[model samples]
Target: MTSTYDQLVEIVTKLHNPPADLIRPDVTFAQLDVDSLTLVEISLRIEGDLGIRIEDNELEEDLTLAATTQLIDAKLAQ
Candidate 1:
């Protein structure tokens, strides 16, 4: 779980050019410059890393940092 969180942090950090100390669980995709296309790439990467495909419909704006971590955790559990 902690490792997944770390992975998400790394992804978000790369997507956004924010300061290292600015990263946090409350950040949203919009704040990180993650548009639809970037989201797709992130989804693909997550699928590759987790070995599970997430449906497009499953991708929601509500899945910000904390929400995304929870969603990934749930999918891996299933």
Candidate 2:
């Protein structure tokens, strides 16, 4: 199975098509130019694809991909 971080990268790639290097773990969604609406879409995709629901408020643009992966992993562990 793909790791949570990899899965998130795939979802973001499908949604935004950003440069590969910009999708690093340290990068925030804001750095990728992801706005509020897109963040909601990304959150929905993550929930659908990963089977873990994350609130919109929890997915701030400042949150890094690594942090998002951790959040998902924590939820999955629950």
Candidate 3:
């Protein structure tokens, strides 16, 4: 199955300036130097990639990759 983690990793790889070869689920956005603007871009990219729309308020700044993946998973499940 195309799990949320997989999707998140794909997006991070595509969007990251330096781009990570592998994205750990536990990694934090701050570690990547992803600011609010980047996160907003990521949100848009996710919707475009997954064909699902997420509210802006739904995303938290402290959202770990793992947590974001979980949130996506839940949204996809719904």
Candidate 4:
């Protein structure tokens, strides 16, 4: 069974549209070179895809793939 984190990563990867190697657990959104609009869109997509509403304030400047997965896992567990 795929773990929630893995599933989250999959969704993020799809939303990010980065190269296969470019998407990694520790890779920050800044490292992805994504603009604020793209980041906001990604958050919205995650909320829609996961059925979890992520507050805008929850998105920190150091957002990373691993951190995103963790956030989703936490929201789902709530």
Ranking by TM-score: 2, 3, 4, 1
Ranking by lDDT: 2, 3, 4, 1
4-68 per-residue lDDT for model 3 (tens digits): 78777778777876356435777788877787877888899989998777788876667888999
Per-residue lDDT of 1-78 in model 2, one digit per residue for the tens?
A: 999999999999999899887879999999999889889999999889889899988999999999999999999999
TM-score of every model versus the real structure: 0.78, 0.96, 0.82, 0.79
Reference-based lDDT, each prediction: 0.73, 0.93, 0.78, 0.76
lDDT of 1 by residue, 36-78 (tens): 7777777887887778777777765546788788888888899
Which sections of candidate 3 miss by over 4 Å?
18-22
Give all candidate RMSDs, comma-separated.
2.3, 0.6, 2.0, 1.9
Residue 68 deviation, candidate 4, in Å? Answer: 1.0
Better by TM-score, candidate 3 or 1: 3
Task: Report the candidate with higher TM-score, 3 versus 4.
Answer: 3
What are the runs in model 2 whose C-alpha is more than 4 Å off?
A: none
**Model 4 clashing residue pairs (backbone):** none
Q: Write the per-residue lDDT of candidate 4 for residues 2-53, one digit (tens) a residue.
A: 8766776676677667677877788888887766777777778878877898
lDDT of 4 at 39: 72
